[model samples]
Target: MIERGEDWVPPLPTGERVAGAKRRSGEGAAPTHPAKRKAGATERARELRLDETKAEYRLWGELRGRHLNDYKFVRQVPLGPFFADFLCREKSLIVEIDGSQHAESLTDESRTTWLNSHGYSVLRFWNHEVLAERRAVLDTILAVLEGQIHSPSPGLRFAPATLSPVGRGGGASHG
Candidate 1:
């Protein structure tokens, strides 16, 4: 062993160095960065859950605790490189509530594509729809879950009155 200068750094393990080289050259699996990214995503999910939008909180009340048709749902779930607003692992479904910021967003499009490729059906509703048209939103979700409405390829964007309620007036009050 030889003494080193104050600014000298130790060499990485041989295997790690090789993996790092491979990653830099784009010739091998990513070198441990994905796990760190996942951890970051998890932390972001937790933060989002803590500061949930009003629409998200309202929808969660209806979806949590196996409340909807007794199917379990988890909110702010981390998935691969993204966090789904709500996910039902058993049903392979994801529900995303979008605000105005999501309008025509390329990032959202790619995120939806990634999610679809992972075998989950995504249902999207605008924040206003979730807040002002709560019944329709819930009905559409239930319809998709029950196979009454086929899962759209990739994902579906829903307008406030796009789908009518299952068996009653469209404006049925949740209260």
Candidate 2:
């Protein structure tokens, strides 16, 4: 028989202390993720849900419960080291609502590229566009989901919030 030293620490089990182990789908309930996530990721997603922006709140109202063209959407879902603002698992799409601070951010560019390579299409809309031109935003989301707008690459298909909400100008246009 082998004996362990007093100073040795036991390995942790992934199935334990993780929120998904208990129940499913709610404020604190964690969805099963393919990528390994830090415990803080689950907590942060919950916190973001609790402290949603006005833009996020308004968008969620329309997207929740398969309301957008009968497509189901989940908010604050963990995607690797980041959290998607809104995600439709079925269509592999993510929607981001941004303010002026995110205008022309290279960080967002890289993030989009990474997410796209992982098979998720990302669409971003400015806060004002979401609040003032909500119907347009919803329509755009539906277009992408229905394949009216095709993204060859997520990063190239998006324009920064600095540009048109319709994203007319990008490195590459959706066909």
Q: What CA RMSD would you report for each candidate? A: 15.9, 13.6
Highest-TM-score candidate: 2
Clashing pairs in 1: none
Residues 67-172 of candidate 1 have per-residue lDDT tens digits of 9989889998765556778986665678999988788554555445445544566789989999999998999898887778763543346212112332112243
Where's the lowest-lDDT run of ten residues in candidate 2?
160-169
lDDT of 1 at 175: 24
Prediction 1 TM-score vs. true: 0.66
TM-scores, one per candidate: 0.66, 0.68
> Relative to the true structure, how large is the alpha-carbon lDDT of every model?
0.62, 0.65
